[model samples]
Target: MLFVKTVTSFMAVQCVRSRVCHRKFWGWLNAVFNKVDYDRIKDVGPDRAASEWLLRCGASVRYKGFDKWQKDYNHLPTGPLEKFKIERIDATESCIMFKGFDYLDYLEHVEEIKFQRCIYIQDECLERLCRIQNLQKSLQWLEIISCGNVTDRGIISLHLLKNLRYLFLSDLPGIEEKEKTLQILIRALPNCEIKVDL
Candidate 1:
């Protein structure tokens, strides 16, 4: 019985060590993914560079004239350097943390953005996004679904996007007092169509 207990304890310790190692590895990888490549941006322009960053982080971007969403980081569409402008982004289940959001700053044609099951998007990310002047004028549609870190503060900050015509919120358990949030948003953005799901 002593030998059995010792072996079991050793096994548990090994398991814990392995899990910690695994977590550390993914954290390192995410950090790497978030690193901004300013040289790449200077060479390729904001739209193309942002596309690469989005795709690398498991997000998809649709170019202005494209019907299909570009998903593969390895097989991004090739064209003239800045010809393919990102018009919409779908960051569902993506690892797009705030550190990588600088890529989106200079994009001028982005009309829509979707954040679904994105684990790294917090209230600060929304605040930064809403403050971008380019997005403030150009973005017209926004969706946030199943992103647990987003709360009423994040939702409220989106009032800066006055051009947004449609906003969808669903499965966001972090948002308390959805009705009050909705009323505030409605008053702030009179023409916008807002939907909230509890």
Candidate 2:
């Protein structure tokens, strides 16, 4: 009787493992048992918020606006995150705005940044971007399409990006001296391919 009971129990366990226990089942169990209590995470300010955003997104994240990002993350800062390289970002037509370069201090490994149709990006933002450490070595491609406030001065600062190979600055009405701007950029980045629509 004891031998029969043990055999039945073992068979039942094997049956459950083969039929009921799958990847989704295990994942659900883990979430239910090891859920993170975000309420306990302390706010470490805006700089940490940027790091947290990268941590959550890994290499890619898309949001409608900054408010959505804040709301989705529960407004808590995450930090001392693992050194993960973010190679690309696309924030086209999003309400995301940059306050300063401080927000991107941790993303030193980013290679491409796009803000196409982001009208809020201005000369000050471009100036701040030029100040990012190691940007000249790491950043290769940039696109700021339809950013009307970015003038020749703003685009000029990008000449500091030594590794920059491709630049797209289309639909910028403020760049009245388009020919001069293109010439200056061409002289600065001889190997770069630049596309502009005055």
Candidate 3:
């Protein structure tokens, strides 16, 4: 009886240790996927390069004149840079951390972006994204759903998107003052229609 109990306890500990090691490995792998390839950006142009990053991180991108999203990184269309300008992005359940946001710097035509159930999105990521000059002018629709890392500061920082017409925020546990954030955004961008649910 003692030997059986000891073996069972040892197996349970090994299983827990294995799970922890696997989780750490996946986290490290996602960090690697979030790395920006500046050389690739130069060769493929900003939109193509950014699309590669987004798709690699389990996000999807829609081109300027297209309705279907490009989800698979391997199946990305190959052509001239002008052929693939990223217009709308849906980043659902993606691991797009702040480090990969550098790819958004040169994109000139992104209009709509949605982040849903994304674990790696936080205040720094939002702050960095909102600071992009092109995005500030071009973005019209923005949605952040079920992103627990977004606090009042990050939500308030979105006022920088001067051209944003619609903003949707829901299920964000980090947002303490939802009404205050909404009021601030409304005051800052009067033309925008803001919706918030804490």
Relative to the true structure, how large is the alpha-carbon lDDT of every model?
0.92, 0.63, 0.93
Flag regions of model 3 displaced more than 4 Å.
none
Model 2, global lDDT: 0.63
In the range 1-198, model 3's lDDT, one tens digit per residue, is: 999999999999999999999999999999999999999999878998899999999999999888888999999988777988999999999999999999999999999999999999999999999999999999999999999988999988998998999999999999888788888999999999888766
Q: How close is candidate 2 to the true structure, as a TM-score?
A: 0.61
Instruction: Give the alpha carbon lDDT tens digit for every residue of 1-198 in model 2.
Output: 999999999999998887766866754543332232233223443334443443333223322223223323344424443322345666566444444235465455667788767655788878778788766677888988888778889888888887889998888877778898889889999888888766
lDDT of 1 at 12: 100
For model 1 the TM-score comes to: 0.96
Q: Which ranges of candidate 2 are over 4 A from the true structure?
A: 1-48, 51-80
Candidate achieving the largest lDDT: 3
**lDDT tens readout by residue for model 1, 43-159:** 999998999999999999999988999999999988796679999999999999999989988999999999999999999899999999999999999999999999999989998
Q: What is the clash count for each candidate, in the order shown?
A: 0, 0, 0
Span of ten consecutive residues with least summed lDDT in model 1: 74-83
Name the lDDT of candidate 1.
0.92
- Taking all chains together, each candidate's TM-score versus the true structure is 0.96, 0.61, 0.97
lDDT of 3 at 15: 100
